[model samples]
Target: MCSLLLVYISVYFCILLFIEFLLPFPSQNRRHNQQINQKSSNFFFVFQISFMPKKMKSRYILLTLSIVIAIIAILASQTLFSTPPRVFIHNPFDILYGIKAISYSAITSVCSHHHHHHHRRKPSHSKKKISICGDFPKNIPPPDTDTTSYLCVDKNGCCNFTTVQSAVDAIGNFSERRNVIWINSGMYYEKVAIPKTKPNITLQGQGFETTSIAWNDTAYSANGTFYCASVQVFGSQFLAKNISFMNVAPIPKPGDVGAQAVAIRI
Candidate 1:
C-alpha cells in the first residue's frame, strides 16, 4: 500500500511538472490572444498558477516537492513500525504444560467423537484373565495358573511381566504349541525380540491407541539397520494384533551415515 501511494504521488508531481513546461506565461502572449483564450474557458481559475511570476512558480514547485517528500517519509516510517515482533519461549514448564494441554484436548475430542458416533468401547467385564482387555486397560491381572496359553504383560506390575521382552523370553524353544501373549494398554520402551527358535507366537494388545512399543535406536547408535528395530520377529507363524511399534529417533539429516531407524523388522 505504501509503495502504491508513493507511485501515485510521484505520477501527480510528474504531471504537474509536465503541465508547467507546456503552458507559457500569460504575460508573454499578446493581449488579444490571451483575452480570447481566457474567455474561451471558465476553468482558467484552476490553471491560474500557469500565469504566476517566476518567484511564485518556483515557490509552488518547492512546496509541492516538500509535501510529497513528507508524505513519503511518513509512509516509510509507518511501514517499518507496523510489523509485529516475534517472541521466543524459554520456559520448560510452560512448554510441558502446553504439550499436556494439547494432548488432553486431543483425547477429549476423540472421546467426544466416539461418543457422538456410539462407537466408544466399553470396559471389559469378563471373569477370565485371558480375555481381551478393552482400550486403555487399567488394573488388569495376569493368569493365576501357569498352564494357560496366554502370558500377560503390563507396565503396572499387575501382570506376569512389566516388559514385553521378558514374556517373549519365557516361551519354550521349538514348542509344537502356539504361545499367545496378551499385552495390556501401556507404553513398553524396550527392544523386543522373538528368536527363530521360538515359533508360532501370537501377540495381542488391548488397542493400538493404548498399547505401544517404542524405542529411539538409530542405525548409528545400534550399529546396524537390522539392530535398530524396536521389535524384531524371526519366528515363523508369528502374528500381532491391536498394537503399535514406533521408532522415536529423530529424522536423519541429508548425507547422514547409518541413521536409518526401523519400527519393526519381521
Candidate 2:
C-alpha cells in the first residue's frame, strides 16, 4: 500500500512539471516573461514546502511498519523451531519428587523380579493317587524277617549297619521289591543321597522329634541350594517317614542378604 501511494505521488509531481513547461510564456515581451517566470518559481517553492511534511510522514510510517514486520517474523521463527520444556507433576512439599519417583520405580521393579524368582523356587504340592507303601507280610517273625528286604541302622553298632548311608549303599540298584531301612533314635550329621538306580526304598525313623539328619553346606560354601540340601532323593517310589531334614547353615548378618540353603530336595 505504501509503495502504491508513493508511485501515485511521483506521477502527480511529473504531471505538474509537464504542465508548467507546456504553458504559454508570451515570448515577444521580455520584461513580462521575467515577471511570469519569477511568479512560477515562487509557486513551485511553496508547493515543495507544503508536501515536505506528508513525504516525511510516509517515510516514518514505512520505517515503523518495517520494524513491526521484522519483530513479528523473529517471534514466529522462534515459536516454530524452539523446543518445549518437558512436563512433570510437581509437589510443593517435596522438592526432589522427580528423583524420588525414579528411585521408587527402580526399587519396585527389583522387588517384583525377586518375588517371581522366589515363587518359582518354591516346591509344589500334589497328592499321589497310588500309595507308594502297600501292606507288608504280617506273618513274618520280627527277628527272622527277610534280610534281603529289611535292614536296620544304629549309631551304637547294635543293628545291621552303623550309618544310614551305609545301609542304603548295601542295597545296590535293588528295584524288584521294596526295601526298608530303620534308623534308631539319634542326631545324624551326614549328607545322604538316594540315587535313581536304587528305587523302591523306604527310610524309617524312630520318631520325628527323636531323629534328625543335618548338614551345613550353603551357597557361600561353593554349593547352591539344590546341592546344599541335607537329604537329596532321586530314586522313584522312595519314601521317608518320622524324620526331620535340616540344613545348619549360618544365618545372614545384619544388613546382609544371602542365597537359599535347602533342607531337602527330591
Candidate 3:
C-alpha cells in the first residue's frame, strides 16, 4: 500500500507542475499583447525625452511664462497704483463753470485792486455807456440818444418809487438785459441784491448826494438784519459812478448793527 501511495503522490506533483506552466486559450494571446504594449510604452517614453520636443516647445514655455508674469503684474498694480475712477460729465453748463473758475483765478492773480484805484477810466476808443444814480440837482437832463441810453435806468425822469431799491426791482423784472440803471437823486431806504443773471449791469449816481442806495445790514446778522448790505450787485461788467453806499444803522460802533453795508459790488 505504501509503495502505491508514493507513486500516486509523484504523479500528482507532476500534474500540478504542468498546469502551472500551461496558459489558458485567451490568456495565451493576452501575454503577447501585453509584451507589445510594454515595448510601445517604453519606446514612447524614450522618444518623449529625446526628440519629442521638436515643435516650438521653448517658445511655448516662454510665452506661457510671460502670460503668467503679466497676470501677476496686473494683480500687483491693483495694490500698488490703484486709483479712484474718474467721473465724466457731459453737461454744457458745467464745462463753462469749471473752465471759467480756473481762468478767472489765473487772470486776477496778476492784477491787484485798491480803494484809490476805484475810478479807472475806460479806453479812449471804446464807447461810453453812462448811467446816472442818486438825486440829480434837477438841472441835468437825461440823455435821449441811444448811444448812452440803453444801460441807464430812471434816465427818462425822476424815480417814481419812494426808494431807489424799488426801481432796481422794477428794472430787474421789466428786462433781463444788462442795460444801465442810472439812479437819480434819492435817499433809498432798503436792502437789494443784483442777481447773477443780470450781467453787464451798470449803476450811476449823482455824485452820491441825491442818488443813494443805502441799507443797514451785516454779515453776522440774520438774513434780513441791518448787518446786510443795502445793495449787493453780483452781475459782471458792473460799473458804478457818483454812488456812495452808506450804513443807515443808528449805531456807529465797529460791530454795530449796520456794520455791513455794501454800496456796490462789481
The most accurate candidate by lDDT is 1
The candidate with the higher TM-score, 1 or 3, is 1
Clash totals for all candidate models: 0, 0, 30
What global local distance difference test value does model 1 have? Answer: 0.74
For 93-193, candidate 3 gives per-residue lDDT tens digits of 45245446545765675454542365364346577666554434553335435433332335335444445555556554334444556666556666667
Which candidate ranks first by TM-score, i.e. highest?
1
Off by over 4 Å in 2: 1-148, 254-259
**Candidate structures ordered by lDDT, highest first:** 1, 2, 3
**In candidate 1, what are the lDDT values of residues 1-266, reduced to their tens digit?**
43345556667776776676677655654564466557647656547666655655685776578577656536544633232121114442343454455567778989999897775466556755664433435534444344436778978776778899999999889866768888988889999989999998888887999899999999999999979999999999898999999999998899999989999999
Q: Give the TM-score of each candidate.
A: 0.45, 0.44, 0.36
Q: Evaluate model 3: give its lDDT.
A: 0.52
Which scores greater on lDDT, model 1 or model 3?
1
Listing every candidate in turn, what is its Cα RMSD in Å to the true structure after a full C-alpha superposition? 21.7, 24.2, 30.0
Candidate 1 ranges with C-alpha deviation above 4 Å = 1-148
lDDT (Cα, 0-100) at 5 in candidate 1: 51
